[model samples]
Target: MVAAALNGGGGQAGEALLTLALPKGRLAEEAAAALRAGGLDVPGEEGEQELVRLLPGSAFGRDLRLLWVRPADVPAYVREGAADAGVTGKDALAEEPQGVLERLDLGFGRCRMVVAVRRAEAERWPARLAGEAGGLSVATKYPRLARRYFLERHGLRPRVLELRGSVEVAATVGMAAAIVDLVQTGATLRANGLVAVEEVLPVSARWIVNPVSLRWKRPLLGELERRLAALAAGEVAAR
Candidate 1:
């Protein structure tokens, strides 16, 4: 069954389309596959493809508009009500948790957020960091989560250095004593002569919705949630 068009639209009979913010790059392709499995006819390709599309209303009256955007921006777009709902990584949500309801763990884009140091220093780094009165210097894309993990969990004061990308190289280049970053295969860490010392969290893609949109577009959102949840359940069963 398809979901109905959202209210408050200026298009054809004043029905607003349910807008979904999808992340660009790899996750976009995977999310498209998931949406298709859940019964929406989204594209199967990624990159340079149509970034936006409005699915014409079907017999069940489903009208969905999809927007492709940077993964880091998905939360903000949904939170600000620019899109009715979105899919983003759990890491993104953990770093900034507000203004949206995290609905489903999509079970794709799996990775581990970990603390890593050069292999030669791995054995001694923890004790050294603990005794460091100056606080531990850490490089990470997720400064908030890194600080929280070190300060609260390990009782170490962390001086977090925020980097947009290539956090793995920070420790090697002496920018920081340790680095907090995502690792899927640990290949990059090995190549950089670093090893994960502590696992902060396991992360995956998540479904989020604006609170106001949920209230106003409950029926449509609920239907989509049901279909996606069923797909996730089936995936788990197969695995």
Candidate 2:
């Protein structure tokens, strides 16, 4: 049944081929696997040196191109129409400007965006932060999310310190009152003597589409969506 859906369809001969932007990492591999399971001819092995590859005579009967990019840049590529569709985490999607459409939840790379404080200071965070003269100093990779969460949820406008990496160390090193970062297993937080106090968002890889592409290539996009959906459902059922 699934094989028929993917293999039977043939896109228009002269139609523009679709470009899919995939993140460089585990999500990229997983997305490729999913597409392959759906009968698309995605190359299984992604070489570190190569940034782009083309799958000719894909399930759509046209060249399907893949662009490997930073995970954070996937949304931008889709939004700017550099690629018609892409896979990116929900965390990245949250910080992106409101232009692209979230087509499906890919359901892999599950993690949580959380606020963590040093274990010793966990109980006093909200109180201490509220009483501080200036405001709570928070460090995070996701400064936008951290700022909005603190302001909206706690009614405290915190001074957000943006860090590209090693956010958990901010609390232990006394750089900030708390840290916001993605937690997959809580091992890193434990190792750093930090404990999660607040969960900002549950994140997973998602399929995002360009609005212009969806409008012009609805049939092609719909077929791809159906096949991917079936693959995702099978994965969920297996677990």
Candidate 3:
């Protein structure tokens, strides 16, 4: 089910344009800024409930179609060929990497995935984990990554509970012994009486391309890469 509203393209000619899946919300502003910084003109009329839009070649130096989707859905769109490329979180890529080639780190939306627990149980985390036997349960939005982390890093077999939101409250309410979640600041965790116990993965937005697109549209994709790479380098250097 592709839940996207397309905007900006005209006629059969638009089908030949390079398409990109751009995440909506906070990352939308950042993605546009990055594209503009790369010297591409981003122009489009905002329409109510539009998820996909096009920028005419006359404005952007190339006929470009943009698919606006929820951040988490970006990878799926690219993988499924709904888009030739996309901007999404590294964590999302990790969750679903098949059929996608990670092209560049766009250098925005930085955060970390971590294992957190109620503050009162911070010191006992290690011992508790060790003593839990085969019944250890962990709550997270990323069950795949969380289960892998515990098994590979700690050698613990855990029952991973996947939740759509509010993973922080898992431990307090006894839904699980701990939670693996993304954190930009510890403010929310602390407010919920939780503290990070282990670092899982460092995350940031990434530019990804469909493998088939890479082969079929090499020149255009390369040019896009070159422009975006320059901006990424500048960001790295300024940091």
Candidate 4:
């Protein structure tokens, strides 16, 4: 499956273009800014309501193209060879890891994947989970990670309810007893009357490349990595 996904490359003509799959939100804006700061003139502001944006080769001295996609789909696009590379969060990478090469840590979009529950039920969480007679219930956008954390890591069985959005409201509306979600700040959790119990993993945006693309498009991809690394270093120094 991994091989099949990585082998679907563009034709010879298309292979000459360095296509990048970028998430369509704040992450995209951050990525575009980073590239521009690194001397690659990435045109098109984010949130432009476009699916694809073609950038002129004169700006970066290479044929560059950008494909806007959902954050979670970035890796898939790269893996499937629809794009040579992509930027996505670590949490999304954890959910899907086949046929993708995580090349660099972009250092933005930082957050944590955590286990949280309503504050009122916080005290009962451990004991209730300890009993294990009836399995616990969890709401999350990442069902795979949530299941592994509960069943494998913690040795507890849980009914994982997959939700697209509004995971915090699950506990309030009686959908689930707890939620496994991403938290950049405690504001959202606190606002939802939920308290984080444990952190599943730390998350940040990552630069990922298709292994096949890495092998074939090494020159352009390598240059991109070099520029982005310098940009990241400058960002850290500025902070």
Candidate 5:
């Protein structure tokens, strides 16, 4: 599905161009800045909310297409070939059920996908369970990854239910035993009386290309990839 968007050479002939999927939110600005820092200048355009709209390749050296999308929709944009490549949070990748290829960590949107329960009920988690037969129920937007992680690592089956915007409400509604969610500051969890039980995974903004596009659009995407990687590496040094 992702093949169609990356087709055709640029004006220079044989200049394979690529379409990248980007999330529209606070993450968008950071993603663009990273691209610009990498030397891929993102040209400003007309009629757009800071939230949506992708930047088309500039007449300048920049030739990649950007499609700004909602947070959850990024995967569909990539998997369906709507965009040849995309930039999104690790949380999205883990949630989507597909054998998609994951490349490069942009490093700016660093966070963690973790398991949590009400602070008062945190002690309910047994250090050791009696057997693998007993199942655990978990809540998350990433039902797929949450279930797989528990099954593969802990040898227990997880009953995972997806929760969206009002995640804290899941706990109060008794819809889940615990939640697997992204934690940036840990304040949200605490405000909801939840404590981190464990981290299912660590995440950041990732540069992903359609497996086929990664090869076909290598020359094009590489232009941006090279720049973002350099900037990400320096974050630690500057601190």
Candidate 6:
């Protein structure tokens, strides 16, 4: 299954190959496993191997091209048509520059995009933070969504400080009043005395394609969209 998604298919669909911009971490490996489980042949061991490949098309007319890319870069690759489509987090789509489009969801890489503030400052949550004269200062890896969520939800404009990493350090140095980041287990948040008071969005790895290429690459993207959608639906029931 994982082997097949990485390779190409044959038949009338042969001329048009659907390439996927796959994430470079666990989601890539997990997605490959899921595709393989759904009868897509799995290939490539992602262990020490970082390079992505396109294997030979099989007789059943199932062939796919998978591209290896950083998870954050997946959207731009798909949106630009550098690859036919991609599997990336919803968070990636949210943070992408403007004009983002994706046709379907792969339903993997479950996580949340949340707004975090210092644990001791729980009383100063969304509403009160907005009342301040200068507004609450925020530090986030995702300045785009944070800004959007804050303004839309709180009716306030915050001074957002975009930080590369160590968002907790930003709070300690008073660079920002709080932070917004991806929270999976809340373990890191607990360690830093930061807790999520607001949630921006729920995120998952999804199937994304270029808006223009949707028609030109219908055979590849269309088939994948159907199969993956079904798999995602079934996965929901199972859960």
**TM-score against native, each model:** 0.89, 0.89, 0.88, 0.89, 0.81, 0.83
lDDT, candidate 1, residue 9?
32
Ranking by TM-score: 4, 2, 1, 3, 6, 5
Better of 2 and 5 by TM-score: 2
User: What local lDDT score does residue 98 receive in model 2, on the 0 to 100 scale?
Assistant: 82
CA RMSD, predictions in order: 4.2, 6.1, 4.0, 4.8, 5.0, 4.8
Off by over 4 Å in 2: 1-15
Cα lDDT for residue 72, model 3?
A: 84
Residue-level lDDT of model 5, residues 17-105, one tens digit each, is 45667778757777767766766656433212533333345413545566678767887777766566777888888778374577777
Candidate 6 error regions (>4 Å):
1-15, 44-48, 58-63, 97-100, 131-134
Model 3, TM vs. native:
0.88
lDDT of 1 by residue, 70-174 (tens): 888999888888788888898899999988899998888889999999999899967878775576799999989898899887887689999999998899987
Instruction: Arrange candidates by lDDT, descending.
Output: 1, 4, 2, 3, 6, 5
Residues 126-178, candidate 3, lDDT per residue (tens digit)? 78988775688999888788878898998987999989988988887877889
Give the Å error, residue 185, model 4.
1.5
Q: Distance (Å) between predicted and true CA of 76, model 4?
A: 0.9
Candidate 1: where is the Cα deviation over 4 Å? 1-15, 46-48, 58-60
lDDT of 2 by residue, 1-239 (tens): 32332242233212457778888876877878877776778877544246766556775786776778988898887887767788889988887748899988877788999999999988886677778666689998887888788888998788999988888888889888888899999999999999998899999888899898888888888889998887777766765
The count of backbone overlaps in candidate 5 is 2
Give one digit per residue, the lDDT tens place, for model 6 in 92-116.
8888845446666667778787888
List per-prediction Cα lDDT, in the order shown: 0.81, 0.80, 0.79, 0.81, 0.68, 0.71
User: Which candidate, 1 or 4, would have the higher TM-score against the true structure?
Assistant: 4
State residue 208's C-alpha deviation in candidate 6, in Å: 0.8
Clashing pairs in 4: none
